[model samples]
Target: MLCSCGSRPDRTGARRLVTPLDERIAALLLAEHAFAPATPGFVGVTVELPAALTGRHQLRHGFLSPRSPGTAALSGPPSPGLEAGIARMADDLDAATSLVGEVTPGGVRVALEAGLEGGGPLGLTRRWALAATLAPVLAAAFANSPSPEGWRSTRQARHRGLPVLRAVSDPRRAWAAYVLEQPGRGGPGLAGLARHVDALRPPVAARGHLEIDVADRQPRDGWRVVVAVTAVLLDDPRAAAAVEEITAPLAAEPALWERAARDALSDPVLAAAARACFVEAYGTLARHGARRDLRDQVAEFTERYVMRGRCPADDVLDAGAGFRPVPR
Candidate 1:
C-alpha cells in the first residue's frame, strides 16, 4: 500500500499492521467474541452505527474462548430482546477509540472473509484466507490512489482504483456482495468477503445479508460489486482534508479507472487521458507551493509515465490493485 501511494513509507505503521494483528489473534480464542482494552499506542476499538439500525449478532471475548471452528445452535426467530442485546454489543464494539469492526451476528458464523473491523473488535482466520481477502482490498486501495505530491510525472499512480473493485472481483455475483457489505447498507459480495462460510463446524445457515437470493437484481453497470472502499472518517480533520484531496483527482478520471484493467494498454483514448493525468497531477503539486524537492518528485514521475511510457511499477508489484496507467 505504501508503495502504491508514494507515501514516503511509515515503517512504524507497517510493522503494527503486520505484527500486532497476528500476536493479538494468535493468543486469543476464536469461538467466542471478545474485546481487549485498548492500550495507548494500539488502536482503540470505538464503533458507531447509524441511529435507525440496531444490527444483530454475537459478541464474544478473544483471549478466553477457543479461536477455532466451533458452533452453537441459535433457535427461534429474531426478537426485540435479541435486538437490544445486539445494540449493546455494537456500542461496546465501537467503544474502541481507534479502530475495530464487528460482525452483525458477531459470534462464530459464516462469511467467507471471516472478519471485519467496524463496530469494534478485529477478526482472525486462517492466515492464507486472510491474505487472499486483503490482497484484493489493498489492490483496490492502491488502484484508487491518485498522484501524490513531489513527483515530476503523476504517471500511472495506483491510488485511483477504489471505486471499480466490484466490477472485476465479482462481476456476476451480487448476492455474494450483499452479505459481504451488509455493514455498508446491504451491498453484495459481503459473504464471500467474510471468508468463513465453509469453515464453521455444524455449519449454520446465513441469513438475509449472507444469503445470495436468486431474485435480487444484478449490480448496475459501473457500481458492480464493491469489494473495496477508501473509507475516510470525515470527523478527523486530517482525514477530512485527505478526502478533499483524493476525491478531486479520482472523480476527475472515472473513465480512466474503469478501463485501467482491460484497456490500460489497449485503449488509445485512455492512454492519452492517462498521460495527461500525469501532467495535471504534477502541475497541481507544484502549484501547491510545496518544497521544490517534493514537487520535483511529481515531475520525475510525470516524465516516467507521460514521456517515457512504461508500465506502472504498481502493475508488476500488484496488478489487481493497479489502476493508474503509465504509457505501456
Candidate 2:
C-alpha cells in the first residue's frame, strides 16, 4: 500500500501556503530521520527496507516523494506488514514537518497493490481486470473528500479525463492500444512505452502488481480501515469471488465512475454494491485471523457508514459551516 499525504504550515491560527523551500526542508528532515538519502525532484527520500519486510533484495527500498508541493508520497510493499509501514511513514512525515507544517485532514491518498496469483502473463491480465472492476466500488465505499461542489470524493472527481482500465479479454493489448492513442510525441519504442506508463494515472495500473488508486484520503486513523478492507477484498479468495459477482453488473452501468464520485452511496446501485463488499470483507477478516482491533474498526466503519449508505464525506457535509476536519 502506497500512501501520499498533503500538509500545510500552520502559523499562529492561520494556515499558510506550503512553499517549495518548505518542501525541501521537510525532505531533508525526513532523509536525516529515516537515515535515507535525499534526492532532488519529486522523489525525495529512499529508505532501505529490511529483507524480512520485503522478502527480497531487489525490492529493498521504499520511497518518499514530495510530488506535489505539500504532499509526501510514501510508497512501499503490501501487507502483512503494511500497517507498520504506513505508521513508520506517518511518523517520519510528522517528525519531518513538525518544524514546518502538519499533515492535512482529507489530504492523504492511498494505492493498494495486490500481487498476481500463479504468476504469468495470464495472471497479470486477470488481476488487472479484477482491480479495474473493483475500482469504482471501492471509491464509493471509502469516499471522504467532501466539498461545496456537492461531490462526495472531490479527489476522485478530479480524476475525470484520466485513463480508466476497463474489464477486457486482453488487457495487455488494450493497454498498448491506449498508450499508442495518447496525445503525445512519445516514441513507439520500449523506453517511450515505459515513459507513457509512468505518466498516466489510471484508476487501476499494472506495475508488476495490480494497483488500485481509487479511494479518497481517510480521516485520522481511518486509513487503516481503508487498507484493511481493500486488502481483504482483493486477497481473500472467497471475498474476491463475491466481489466479482457483485460488481459484474457495474460493467454495464453508464458513467459508473462518474456516479461513484458524484453520488457515491447516494446512488442506489453503488450503495448496494458497497454494502455487500464491506460485508464480505468483514467476514473474510474474521475467518482469516486478522487482528481483533482491525476487525472491530472495519465493523464500526461498516455500521456507521456502509450499512447506512453513507461515508466519511457525509460527516463533513453534515457539519456544514462549523465543520472542522480532524486535526493531525
Candidate 3:
C-alpha cells in the first residue's frame, strides 16, 4: 500500500503515522478475523486473510489490511486452525512492536495457492514450475522502488538478477524436500511448512500451494495487470513459451539485473520480450473469456510499460515524493 501522510504530508509526519496506524490496523484486522504484523519500515502494515475473496472484495480487504496494504491471497482450501494460529501470532507480535521490515515505497506481494486443476502433488509441481518460469518478467513489470536521490529503481533491486532457486526446477519430491527441509522453520512436516509459509516469500511452494511474490505497491490498476499476467503465464502454454524464449538467454549474463533493474524496458531485448509476452497474454486472456475490463487493463499495462519502456517505479520517480535515499 502507498503510505500517504494525509494533511501532514512531509517525511517526518509520515514516519510518525506509521507506528500508530500500524498498531491500530493490527487491532482492527484481529477484530475482523485477519492476521497482520505492524510493519517496521516506512508507514505501512500487512494484514493477511485466511481465504481469498472475489477480486474486488480482496482488494477492498487488502486496502483495509494496511489499515491495509494489498498483501492479499488468492483462492486456497480452508485452513481454519492455521488461520487461527497466525492470527494469534500476529496479536503477540503486535503487542511487542510496530516495526515490519520491507516497508519500502514499492512493496506488495500477492500469493495464490499453487494447486492446479488435476489436484495432486504433480499438479502442485506444475504450478510451481510455471510460476518460476515467469518470475523474472513479472518482477520487471512490477518494479516500483526508485530512490528520490537518483539511485536507480527497485528497493529489492537484488531480486532483479538473482538466479532462479535451484529447487524451482527440481523434480516434485526434490522441491518439496527443499521447502520442507529449510532449517529455520522446524523439522520437516506440516507444522514446519506452516512456520515457513509467511517466512518464505513467493514464487515459493510449500504444503501444496504456491505464491507469486513478484509485484510491488502498485497503482490500483496494476492489480489487474498482475492478475492478468499471472493467469496467462500459468494457464496459457503459448504465452509461457514466449516468456521462456525471452528470458532463457539471461541465465548466463554476469550482471543480468542491470538490464532488468537499471535499464528496464530501455534495454532493447528485454523490451521486445516483455512486449511479446504481454501481447500473447492478452490474446490468451481474450480467448479464455476473461472480463472485458481485465483484458483492457492488461492491454493498457502492456502498452504503458512494455511498449513504452516505463514501469510503475518510473512514475514514482517522476513524482519526486515516491522515494528517499536508502538508509545506510
Report, for every candidate in turn, its global Cα lDDT versus the true structure: 0.27, 0.58, 0.49
Per-model TM-score on C-alpha atoms? 0.24, 0.69, 0.58
TM-score: the better of candidates 1 and 2: 2
lDDT of 3 by residue, 1-328 (tens): 1122334346555523322223233223223321121111111123233222233322211232222244432222222222222233334333322233222223434344444434323244444554564566666677776676543455446555455542233345444444434436432333333445446553444333344566666665354466557655654545555655665565554554545666566667656667777888889878778667778878888888778977787787777876756434
lDDT tens digits, residues 1-328, model 1?
0011123336565522222222123112211222221211111111222122222343441111223333122212221222222333334433321222322221122122222322211221111122222222222222322222211112222222423222122211322332233332211132322243233211111221121110001111111111101111111223323333333333334544434432342345444433544444445444445346545644554454434443343334344442333432
Sort the candidates on TM-score, descending order: 2, 3, 1
Best by TM-score: 2
How does model 2 fare in lDDT?
0.58
Could you tally the backbone clashes for each prediction? 73, 0, 8
Candidate 2 Cα errors over 4 Å, as ranges: 1-61, 78-101, 104-122, 160-166, 183-195, 321-328
